[model samples]
Structures are given as structure tokens and as C-alpha cells.
Target: MTSIITHNDQELLKLIGERQNHQAFEVLYQRHFDAVFRYVFKVMQDRETAEDVVQNIFISLWKKPPSLNHPTLLPYLFGAARNQIAKEIRKNKWNKEQLDFIENTKGICSTDEYLEERDTRKLLESGIQKLPQKCRNVFKLSRFSYLSNKQISEKLGISVFTVENHIKKALYLLRQSIEFIVICLVSWY
Candidate 1:
């Protein structure tokens, strides 16, 4: 396993600018991904969107090395990210407007109460999707089959505590996903 050294941004830029410094770029990628991503996320405030922006930023960096125009490369990258984030904000605004329009115009009575909130449902579905397969199956069995934890454990051939733990983890992830969605929705304004 190649251990990564923590290179300062200037060191990274110099290495990245070199033709044979692939390892340095790799190290830089590992080092700066989280910081740059968090910076983008702070502005964009959406993980999926931030991920996309981060990927794009790194890709552009690889494709086009920093020229002399960017004497300070980290800030240059951050500036690029900021610009990308502004574009994303504008796009999100347009999307929210369209979503709101559709939601408002659609008769509330026409929608089933359970189905009216797509974002929440998607959040839950995504949370469930992220679970380990066993945990997901156990959670579904408990929820859909309406079985007690003991029953679920028996059916799954696992201990009751395991079943309970799986269910708890699933619920925790779902709650977290929902909270994130709620925060995003609230922050839309």
C-alpha cells in the first residue's frame, strides 16, 4: 500500500504541473478531495451535487494543468469551485421553481396522502438502499411483514439483538437522510 504524504497546496501544484508526477496528483486528490468537496458543499449544500461538482473540478484539473495565470493554484481551484457552485445554485433555483409550480398546480386531493411527499419517500428509499443487504432485508421484513424483532430474528436465523441492531441502524440512516433532505428543503429559501 502506498502511503500518501500530506503535501501543501503549493507542493501539489508544482507536482501536478510536472509531466511525470502522477503520484503527487494522486496524493493531492486524496488530500484535497474532502476539503474542496466540503467547500463546494457549504456553498451548494447538496451532497450529490457537491460530488458532481468535485468530480468535475478534479477532472478539469487533470485535463488542464494550472497555467502561470493561476500563481496560487488552491485558491484558483476554489474560485473555480465557487463559480461552479453559483451555476449549480442557479440551476437548483430553476428546478425548485419548476417543482413548486408542479406541486402547487397539481390538486392536493388528486394526490394520495402517502405519496404527496416525493422527496421524503426518495430519501427513505435511498437510505434503505445504502444499508447492507442483510440489514435492508431484515428492516423490510420487520416493516412489511409487521413482525416482532424476535420473529424477524427467528425468520432470518439471527439473534434478536442482531435484528434489533439492524433495525436501529436502518432507522438511524433513514432519519439522517430525512433530516438532510429537510435541511436542503429549508435552505432552498
Candidate 2:
């Protein structure tokens, strides 16, 4: 058994593609699973859906390992996540724009409801503003700039794993902040 720990991505790919080494593949999967899962979960925001997509991605990798000439595995994995998320969005017929419009229109039937919606949005924005600087930057790059983790990593001079962790942390903090805001608003009303 090779010391899979010492194998770089190309070595791992070669082992999987040519030698059909299951251990090499398992090593690759173990190395990247958390980052890939976190990346997909950031987009899907549903544990089950993210798990399924990550599973499909790893399965596809096993079926067809990418070429050895490719630079790093992180970009390819993140691209696959983006593509899979896009496919799921298409399958559900609910792109973000459409979802945003639907959500915006929900309370348009009444002025008070519209005001409440505005307040909720403001609260969410405030929560975002309170994020730690790096976390906020990573989150914006991933969500607003639509940059993959690899891109953000390169641009920020950080690791892909760091980018993923920042994003995950940002999401957790934001969710908690929003939930607290909701509770406060409910209590006040």
C-alpha cells in the first residue's frame, strides 16, 4: 500500500485513473470531502441536497478521473459543485432571481407587511455587516462575486480550505444573528 498521505493530487489521479487503486481514490475523497461538502452546502443550504450532490460528484470522479495536466483538484471540485447546484436550481425551476422576486412580492398585498419585510431585510444586512472582516470578504466573494473557493483563495493569498471555513463560519454567524433578530422582532410585536 502506497503512503497515500505523501501523494499529491496528480499522483492520486494517476493511481486512480491508470492503476485503478481504490485506496488512492479513498485518499482523494477523504482529503477533499469536507471542503466540497461545505462548498456545496453554501449554495444548496440543505444538508440532504448537499450530501447527494457531493456524493454524485465523488462518484463521477471515480467513474472518470480528470486529466493529469490539470493544475489543482480544488478548482475542478468547486466547478463541479457550481454545475451541480445550477442543475438542481434548474430542476426545481427556482433560480435566485425568481425566488427573490417571489419572496419580495409575498408581502406586497399590504403596506404593513411590506414594511415588515423591509425591516427583516435591514436586520439581515446589519447582521452581515457585523461579520468578522475576513469572513465577510470570503462570503461576499463566494456569494456576490460568484467566485469559487479556488479563485478566492488565489485572490486573497489564502488556502481553499481557509476560504471554505470562512464561508461556513460566516453562514453560521449570520444564521444565528438573523434568528436572534427574528426572536426579538416577534417579542416586540
Candidate 3:
């Protein structure tokens, strides 16, 4: 008897979780899909990967709606998107252009430099993984996704100040982790 749109996120989530209500799920999906898609697209920079990631997020929600302590679901959805993106990256499934660029660069750099660069990249990624969860998410959205502070704030449901702080913390930890590589590179040149 009531319009689904009138329900808040928690109420709709309850309907989906308790009753397996398709209408509630659809309403929730419609409410957040565009924002989630745009966020994933920006991070993935590939339309197909972005679509798949967004679809999976919604599918997972429908299959098993999460119990949320937060007032809104945007943060959870975004976290799921980040996890999917990380999985894709870890799979080493680079697009053709990325692979081509890597292949093209092999001829330009010395083997030693190339290897060192690769190692440095690995160290940075390791450092990112070691970061606090919230900090890592903010850093990836800011650096890898190339999103503005305002954009990240809106997506993560955090203030811009919080975004900046996380970015700062991530950078500091990453710099510490890779300081030796930077010193070596500088000394070589």
C-alpha cells in the first residue's frame, strides 16, 4: 500500500533481506545504480569492466542483502566496487592498450631499470594493501581513479577533509615503504 520510494535505505534493505522483496530491491538498485556505475567507471576506465563490476555489486545485494549498521548503503556499495576492482587488478588482466604500452617500453629502458621500476611498483602496491581500509579506499579513488576530493567525499559519504587526511596518510606510508627505491634512483641519476 505504500510507495517504495518513500522507504529509507535501511527499510528497503530490511524488506529485501527479510522478505526477498523484488520491488524493494529494484527501488534500491535504481536509487544507487548510476552513482555506483559512475564511480566504478572512473576507477576502471573501461566501460565493460565497469558495467560488470556494477552489475555484480547489485547482483550480490539482491542475492544476499548485507546487514548494515550505517544509515546509508552507498558506502557498502562503493566498498564492494573497490574490492572488485582490486581483484581485477590482481588478476593482471590489463587492457590491450596497457599491454601494448608495456611491450613498447621494453625497448626503451635498460633491463635493470625496468626490473627496478617493476619492483618499485610492487612495493607501492604492497604498501597500499597494508594501509588502513578507509585510507586505502580514499587513496585509490584519489590517485588511481583520478577523482576530485569533492567527488570522493560524495561517493564515500565522508567529508572532503576526511578524504584529504586519508590521502595524506596513504602517501606517507607509501613513501616510507618506497623510500629506498627513490634514493637508489636518485643516486643513479
Candidate 4:
């Protein structure tokens, strides 16, 4: 068997798409699996779902390999992965909203308890806002944007170590502030 490793992506893609060479498809899968998996896992945040998505992406590639040039292949794969992730998120959100609506209609909680929960959530939000600028940005990217530490680093142009430190500091500050709020509330009670 000719080693597909030495072949450029263009050659490998042509072999798979035009010639229907299954081995060539295997080589493409091996080459791009880790990168595609990481990107998917960063967005999905679940190992099982991410793995399934990656497999589906590869299967799609095999079934209908685009006329992707070598230089554009990785970006194309990433774009597809992002699109899949967006669709999954939308589906999950819709399901959650339906459940929330059903539960709310059932009158699960009293008005007072709902008010307390809202106050607690507001306090947490304030605590997050009190974080130092860089720390807050990193924390928001990690939590709200759902970005991995490496992705945050790349987007923010910082080292991964710095991103980790910022997240840790943000978390610590928020925890301390929340604890203080709880203590004050308990003392009042």
C-alpha cells in the first residue's frame, strides 16, 4: 500500500473522492481527527456527544467529499463542526425552554421562594461584575462564551497559563463575595 502520509491533502482528497479509495479516506481521518475532535469537544463539552459529532463529520466527508483544496480543508472542517454545534445548542435550548414552561405552569415554587432565587442570582451577577477586568473577561469567555482555556488564550492573545490563572482568580473572588453575602443574610435571620 502506498503511504498516504507523504501525500498532500489535495492528492489524498482526490484519491478518496474521485477514486473511491477507502484507505485514502482513512488517512484523511487520521490526519484531522485530533484537531476536529478538540474543536468539537470545546463547544459540546460532553465527551460522548463530541465523539459522536466527530464521527458524523467524518462520515459526511466520506459520503460527499467537497472539492476542498489542501490549504482550505482544515477551515472547512472547523466551519462544519461549528455549524453542527450551533444546531445542537439550539435543539437543547428549545427542549429546555419547553420543560421550563411546563414546570412553571405547574406552579412548582411559591412567589417568595422565586423572589429569593432571583435575589441570589442577582447577587451572583454582581459578584462576577466585581472581578478585575482581565479576570472577568477570561471568566466570561470560559463560562458564557463556552470557550476552552486554549481557545480563550488564542482569542485574547494570552498564554494558556495566564488564562487559567485569570479564571481561578475570578472564581475565587466570586466565591468569597457570595460567602460574605450568605453570612450577612444568615446574621440578619
Highest lDDT: give the candidate number. 3
**Model 4, poorest ten-residue lDDT window?**
100-109
Residue pairs in collision within model 4: none
* TM-scores of all candidate predictions against the true structure: 0.42, 0.50, 0.49, 0.48
lDDT of 3 by residue, 7-26 (tens): 97889999999999999999
Give the Cα error of residue 16 in candidate 1, in Å: 2.6
Model 1, span 1-189: residue lDDT tens: 334365555666666777637777787688667656766665554668889998889888876667644223445656667667656666767356434433343333222432354455567778888888998999998865457898888888999999999999889888887788889989997
Question: What TM-score should be assigned to candidate 4?
Answer: 0.48
Query: Arrange candidates by lDDT, highest first: which order?
Result: 3, 2, 4, 1
Q: What is the lDDT of residue 103 in candidate 1?
A: 39
**Sliding window of 10 residues with minimal summed lDDT for model 2:** 102-111
Instruction: List candidate 1 segments past 4 Å from native.
Output: 1-7, 67-73, 94-189
Per-residue lDDT of 42 in model 1: 51
Each candidate's clash count: 0, 0, 0, 0
Please say which candidate is ahead in lDDT: 1 or 3.
Answer: 3
Tell me how far the alpha carbon of residue 147 in candidate 3 is from the true structure, in angstroms, after superposition. 19
Ranked by TM-score, the better of candidates 1 and 3 is: 3
Better candidate by lDDT, 2 or 4:
2
**Which is better, 1 or 2, measured by lDDT?**
2
